[model samples]
Target: MLKPYNKKPLSYAKQVHHLQSKGLSIHNVAWAEGILAKYGYYRLSAYWYPYRIRSGNNVLDRFKPGTSFEKIVQLYEFDTELRLQIFGAIEIIETFYERN
Candidate 1:
């Protein structure tokens, strides 16, 4: 049988607190909360995963010392920009192909 979903929702402050407790430095709490509210903690987790330190059990519960929330945001922004550029390029190529 599958286990029941028992995860509780966290407030923006709690989310920021959790990330801080995990060694992530936030330059601006409000800004970080806005980002978290917009993209969500789980989605942002992937961006921050690279800065995390691997534990003995292979779990990434802690971040490397000096890892900043801004850095993770930068990575997320870069990914978003790259995706937009790729899509634009594909659209151009498709339009050109259709014209020929």
Candidate 2:
């Protein structure tokens, strides 16, 4: 059986606070909130996961010292751009195959 989705929604400010509590160094609150509002916490988590410092059993619950929000944003933007490029290439391939 699957578990129910009982998680409450967090405001952008709360999200920033959560990251701070986990040891992330956020340089600009407004910019981080804007990104959180746009891409959402869950979506952006993937980009920031690499910066986390895992120790013992709580591997997913902490971040490395001095991990900045800007770095995560840069990773997210790079992933987005790479996805677009890959999609464009796939489209071109499909068109060529269709014409053959």
Candidate 3:
């Protein structure tokens, strides 16, 4: 069965507020807002998933204790860089094979 999506879209400021309400520590509001604006909340949420509180097989909506927003940003940055590096390597490999 299919269900309708009931969640509403939130602005960047509201997204920050939501995270704070969920127990995420935002050391810099402006920086967090900027990241959210650039990447959108959905993309950044993946980075913060590990920081969320969990019990057994169920993940809660709230974050774990001491889960900082800056750490989430760092994780996203690291993942982006890692993906770029991996793609660069693949491109190089393809180029080498084509010349042979």
Highest-TM-score candidate: 1
Candidate 2 residue-wise lDDT at 57? 54
Greater lDDT among 2 and 3 belongs to 3
Question: Model 1, range 6-93, lDDT digits (tens) per residue?
Answer: 9999999999999999999999999999999999999999888888898775967899999999999989989999999999999999
Global Cα lDDT for candidate 1:
0.94
Task: Give the poorly placed runs of model 2, Cα more than 4 Å off.
Answer: 1-6, 56-60
Q: Score each candidate by Cα lDDT.
A: 0.94, 0.90, 0.92
Task: Tell me the tens digit of each residue's lDDT in model 3 across 1-100.
Answer: 8899998888889999999999999988888899899988989888899888898999999999999988888889999999999999999999999999
- Selected candidate, larger TM-score, 1 vs 3: 1
lDDT of 2 by residue, 1-100 (tens): 9999998998899999999999999999998999998998989998888788877755667798888999988989998999999999999999999999
**TM-score per candidate, in order?**
0.92, 0.87, 0.90
Model 1 weakest 10-residue run by lDDT: 52-61
How many angstroms is residue 63 displaced in model 2 relative to the true structure, after the best TM-score fit? 0.8
